[model samples]
Target: MTNEASRPAVDLYSDTVSRPSAAMRQAMAEAEVGNEQAMEDPTVNLLCERVAALLGTEAAMFLPSGTMCNEIAYRVWVDRGEEIILEESAHALHFEAGGPAALAGAMVRTLKGRCGIFDAAELETVIRAPRGHHGQRQKLV
Candidate 1:
C-alpha cells in the first residue's frame, strides 16, 4: 500500500528529515555532553576552539540553530529601530516569524534578488540618507 503524494519530488524543506550515519549515531551516543552555559561541555568547547582556530579568531561561541545565530548577529550589529536589508527570500525574514523585527526591533527592507543575492545597484536604490529623526537608521545588510 503506497501513495505517490506521500513523498515530494525534492525534499529540501528542513534539516529535520535527514538521518545520521551509523558512525555519527555511535559518536553521538558516546559523546561527553554537559552544560553549555557553564562551558562545561567538552565537545562544544573543542568544536568552538577548532572552528575559531580554522577561522583565525581568538574565540568563538556556539549557537545550536541558525535562527539563534541570526538573532545574536542582529543584536550585535544593529540596534533597536534600525534597519537591515535582506533578500525577499531570506530565511530570517520568512521562516523566523519576524525575528528581525520582534527580537532586535529592526525594520526590514527586502530587495527582490536572483537566488537571494542582490547586486550593488539594487542595494544603492534602497539605501537612503538619514531623512530625519522619524526615519529609520539604515544598518547592516
Candidate 2:
C-alpha cells in the first residue's frame, strides 16, 4: 500500500478567492472604462467584437456575468408564463433565487439526472407542445 499527498500550484475552486497577478492588476488600474449599458465601454465593445469575429458571428453581446446572460436569454427565448426545462441541479435553478420565475416570468421544470446530466430521451419526455389558451408553452431548455 502507498499513500501520497499532492499540493496544487493554483486553486480554481472559486473565483471569490482568486487573486490577480501584478500585471493583471496594473491593466485593470489603467483600463479605460465607460458605461456598458449604452455600449459606450470600449473595452467591452472590443471584447464583444473579438468574440464575434472568433465565432464567425455578425455581432455579440458582452454581459457582465452568467446570471445576466441567463436572464437575458430566458427573456428573449421564452415568453411570460412559458416553461423552461432544466436539470434540478442547474445553477439558475438552484442558485439564482427563482430568476426564471421572477425576472423572466418563466415556469421552471426540473429534471433529476445523475451529476446534472440527462439524456436526450429524458428531455424528449418533458417537451410539451403549445396548447394555446390551455397550458403554458414549453419553449426553452
The window of 10 residues in a row where model 2 has the poorest summed lDDT is: 1-10
Query: How well is each residue in 103-137 modelled by candidate 2, as lDDT tens digits?
Result: 99999998877756899988887876678897998
Residue pairs clashing, model 1: none
Q: State the C-alpha lDDT per candidate.
A: 0.89, 0.85
Candidate 1 minimal-lDDT segment of 10 residues: 9-18
Each model's TM-score? 0.85, 0.78
- Relative to the unseen true structure, what is the C-alpha lDDT of residue 1 in candidate 1, on a scale of 0 to 100? 83
- Per-residue lDDT over 21-88 for candidate 1, one digit per residue giving the tens place of the 0 to 100 score: 89999999999999989999999999999999999999999988878988999999999999999988
* Model 1 quality (TM-score): 0.85
Which numbered prediction scores highest in lDDT against the true structure? 1
Residue pairs whose backbone atoms clash in candidate 2: none
Clashes of each: 0, 0
